[model samples]
Target: MAHQESSVLQLKQELLRANMDKDELQSQNVDLQRKMEERSQLAAEYKKELTQKEWLIQQLQGKLDESHRKLSEANYQK
Candidate 1:
């Protein structure tokens, strides 16, 4: 029957549209996952840099303390 054929055609079109939508959503999901990985790597690099800076600051503080101690000793001898 023509009516049955028409119904089948409409159903097929709907199925095709649904498949396209699914493909688009999958692509978007993959993009989001890639961005998340990039951000995670950046965060790790920042953390490493921060740790290095903290170590440098501690080294400088130790040297400053040593200088102050020597200065105090020199003053006491005078």
Candidate 2:
């Protein structure tokens, strides 16, 4: 009877340790998911900003080309 009681106590202690390990793993998983979401949002914002800058660069190049053509025409006429 003493041996049986000792075995039962040992099993209960193992079960408690398993439960604590499971809880810690679940907490870590939640934190990782939250960080992934934040990184995704930041990546989207950066992509949008890059697209806007590209469009502005194109507009500036078009204006520069037009100015160069006008200057050439004036010099040719002189």
Candidate 3:
């Protein structure tokens, strides 16, 4: 009977340890998820900025081309 009681106590301790480990793992998972979301948001913002810069570059190129054409026309008139 004493051996049986000791076995029961050991089982109870094991169960408690398992529960604690599970809780810790769950908390870590939540932290990782939050970090992933933040990274995704940052990536989206970077993409938006890159697109705006590309558009601005295109506009500048168009203006340069127009100026070149005007200069050529003026020279021809002279």
TM-scores of all predicted structures: 0.81, 0.82, 0.81
Worst 10 contiguous positions by lDDT, candidate 2: 13-22
lDDT of 2 by residue, 2-51 (tens): 99999999999999999999999999999999999999999999999999
Question: Model 3, 3-59: lDDT tens per residue?
Answer: 999999999999999999999999999999999999999999999999999999999
Candidate 3: the clashing residue pairs are: none
Best candidate (score: TM-score): 2
Instruction: Tell me model 1's lDDT, rounded to 2 decimals.
Output: 1.00
Question: Per-residue alpha-carbon lDDT of model 1 for 1-78, expressed as tens digits?
Answer: 999999999999999999999999999999999999999999999999999999999999999999999999999999
Pairs that collide in candidate 2 are: none
Question: TM-score order of candidates, best first?
Answer: 2, 1, 3
lDDT of each: 1.00, 0.98, 1.00
Backbone N/Cα/C clashes per model: 0, 0, 0
Report how far off residue 42 is in candidate 2 (Å).
0.5
Clashes of 2: 0
| TM-score-better candidate, 2 vs 3 | 2
